[model samples]
Target chain A: MSSKNLIIVPIFNEAWNLPLLFERLGALKKSWDVLYINDGSSDSSKELLEAQGSNFIDLAYNIGIGGCVQTGLKYAFEHEYDYAVQLDGDGQHPIEALSELLEEVNSNECDIAIGSRFKRDKKHPVGRTRRLGIRILSSTIKVLTGQTILDPTSGYRLFNRKSISLLSENYPQDYPEPESVVFLLKNGLRICEVPVRMNSREGGISSIHRDGIFYMAKVMLSMIMVVLRPKESSHGSR
Target chain B: MEADNLVDINRVQYIAIAVSVVYLLAILYLIRGKKIREEYSLIWLLFGVVFIVLSIWREGLDWISNLLGVAYPPTAIFLIFFMAIFLIMIQFSLIISRLSRNNSKLAQDQALIKQKLEQVEKKLSEK
Candidate 1:
């Protein structure tokens, strides 16, 4: 039997970009099962999903992005998917990179593969300040876990069954991306990055843009906390 | 001069008693109206009772101050009040942490179940 792969798309009020995302995701549906998680969207997103007969789960209320993604992870874990990929709903993550990410994990190269926008690819560039912030976070992760992650803030990621089970159990809630890299590394799981071009969001406000300075400070603090936390004792036994 | 000092102390005592009474009554009213759950109201109620006791028992405040070696008896009131507020704040923080943890877990479970039910329903409909 072929391996079961899942693409978890976490959406929140992305009515404007949903059509294009759905179309792009449709091409992969033949080989992968798509799960759309509606994070209590207040737009036409719910209706759009329903009209298309898309397989999705509507959250009762707005849980932040971390919680939204965790819900997807939990579904992937329960379904026993061999590999799972997370693609943002705002169209920033390129669906074409999914295969490359899957290859890294499928070949036993790493437990988790992150689609890095900065390794060598400069097709899509973030703002100067945002780039600086990600650099600081990258160094922090390096110092804490000795892992050099070029794009710590990149949301485009793929995980194998091992990483999925770990993250689904104890994923961070607020500003999870950077902290999660440290979290996974601290748990003894290998993480590698592949250079991939990203698309600027089609519509809707970026979470970091709303409170850039404060967001940087909060994410930095959370990464420190994750480092200081005790590692799971199951590392040695497993 | 000694009589004036006594009168001032009495005035302070009266103010403390009045404030404690109002606070206690407010807590009772909230409990009666079901505004505060019984589990959480217990702490406020206990604090109100302690406030009333310390306000009326001048000797008790004096004794606590003597025990702590505080120069002034009123300083004892401030210490006790600060400690109570600190404890209550810690309690609130604990409660909030548990609430947020539960909330996310509930959302995750609800979403998964909803998806499963939809899939089952779809399968049934196809039949």
Candidate 2:
């Protein structure tokens, strides 16, 4: 409440889990401002958000998850919030681990704090093939950036002002998690992770499951492109 | 025997010339109706002109084939057509990428503006 922290929740068609996600968010210890950026949900999500009177922005059309999250970061950047945290609307990221992430950013420990589900323990609720896919992405990041990110695919993350400003202007479009990690690291931003227990998706199908093989291939290619991109001379220049 | 082959080649050229004329007319009609932007129509117009020239000048095709070291003049025509198609495809991809980027940026800005408008309305009503 005291700190200028904004929690960004990017929602698509998670109508079934919106109530529970809101409840968990309301139960958090610190009353940080929450911003929900809806990615053109065709379901009852817009009505629910309106009825609840929660602060949210319903996009005109679906722009994918990357654009949804970047909108929140843009809001944070415009409002001059000190830190911005990203949480999934599927109820995967634990609310309890938020404090640790904020603490790390608050103490200047790192520019970004990622809530990793497979830090010390390699156990995850996803299928073996999907787990292997994440492992491949992690290894790719390590090889490319020289930084071993235990869980590069984790969407639960906290970004400071520097990262918020940088990402708001430019973020990946499709399957952005791993590629954005490489993007941030390449720009001289430090990223560390805190182990957090994640809940299996409460509602809606996983995005990666529908196109498992294709998703892996695209994300891998995107990471390589990120590495090949020239560093921006100015951080937030258009 | 050589005279017979010449007649057959001229027949093929006549058919090609007819097709080229029709293609060029179609492109012009589309441009006149504003169905296709002038900028994009330029390439199609260029294609039509090239096709007509190649069809009218029978010796031009053979000359190009000889210049390119191609065994057959028909093969040379196909090669040029494919190269043009490749260039057009790349141009289309570039246009689509720029359009999608602008589309997403517009969507994001619209959402933000709507939110701000709502807040302003709420404040005005409270006052």
Candidate 3:
């Protein structure tokens, strides 16, 4: 039996990139379900999404990336989907990598599979500050959990039903990607990183560019908090 | 002259008393007008009362300041004011964090309900 997989694409003011994203995902050979989460966009993003007649959830207001993704997970949990794949709406995470992420998750090798840009041999140009921030987060996760996450900040990921349920109940808020990695590791959830190439965003501003130092500090603080947080008793259970 | 000698009434003390009265009146007005919830207004009311008491009892303020080892009594007023402000700020932060968390939960619940309703509506229409 084919696994019930739902693709969650959380969008925020990416009206321009919607058409191209639709085209790329539409070209996929596999018939996968996609849910577009409109994160309280003031732009014509909702109108564009409506025009496509795609399934989507319109949040009342912007609640950041974590809230958006958690909403999708809630949907997946309610609908009883076996697996959920998170794909960014900005087109940075390549649509072609979806299959590899799904394959890993479906194989039952890991409860969650992340698409790591740093795992590949090819060099992706990154800003010095961002590279340093990423390195700090990567090392922090490594030191705390003893698990090396090559791309702790990667938004592209696939979560099995157990993770979907767990995260649906409780998930991080702002800058959640790395912090969530630590949370999952602390909870003893199996994680695997698959090498994937990422394209520079087609359009729209990157969320990380707004507050460089403050964002980094918050992320580091969140990581430390996650490390110190007591393990949940119901962890690793269906 | 006896009462005047007993209380060291000064311009700063008068100003502090006036400010405290105004703050207390403002808080009462807000509560009466339903602008601020009664539960939250309690803290402001308490602050207003403390200010009023400290303004009226100069010697008491000095005694507390001396006990705290603060060199200047007026500086104690400023210090207490700042501490109250800081505590209020922390309270606001906590309230906002809770509100945002609930807001997100409400959004998620609403989205799930809407999706389910749409599905049911579609199924009914097909039948």
* Reference-based lDDT, each prediction: 0.88, 0.90, 0.87
TM-score-sorted candidate list, best first: 2, 3, 1
Candidate 3: which stretches are off by over 4 Å? A235-238, B1-11
Q: How far off is each candidate at the interface, as Cα RMSD in Å?
A: 0.7, 0.3, 1.1
- Worst ten in a row by lDDT for model 3 chain B: B3-12
For candidate 3, write residues A137-210 as lDDT tens digits.
Answer: 89989999999998898889999998998898778989889989999899899999999988886776554566
TM-score of each: 0.90, 0.94, 0.93
Clash-forming residue pairs, model 1: none
Q: What is candidate 1's lDDT per residue for B62-126, written digit by digit as tens?
A: 89999999989888889988999999999999999899989988988988898899889989999
Q: In model 1, which runs have C-alpha deviations exceeding 4 angstroms?
A: A122-124, A234-238, B1-9, B25-35, B62-76
**Ranked by lDDT, top first:** 2, 1, 3
- Using Cα atoms, each model's DockQ against the true complex is 0.80, 0.86, 0.61
What TM-score does each prediction get for chain A alone? 0.94, 0.95, 0.94
Candidate 2 segments whose C-alpha is farther than 4 A from its true place: B1-9
Residue-by-residue lDDT tens digits, candidate 2, B1-127: 8877667656787899999999999999999999999998899899999999999998999999999999988999999999999989999999899999999999999999999999999999999
Tell me the deviation in Å of residue A2 in model 1.
Answer: 3.3
Tens-digit lDDT track of model 3 for B5-102 = 87765977899899999999999999999999998888899999999999888898989899889998888988898999999999999999999999
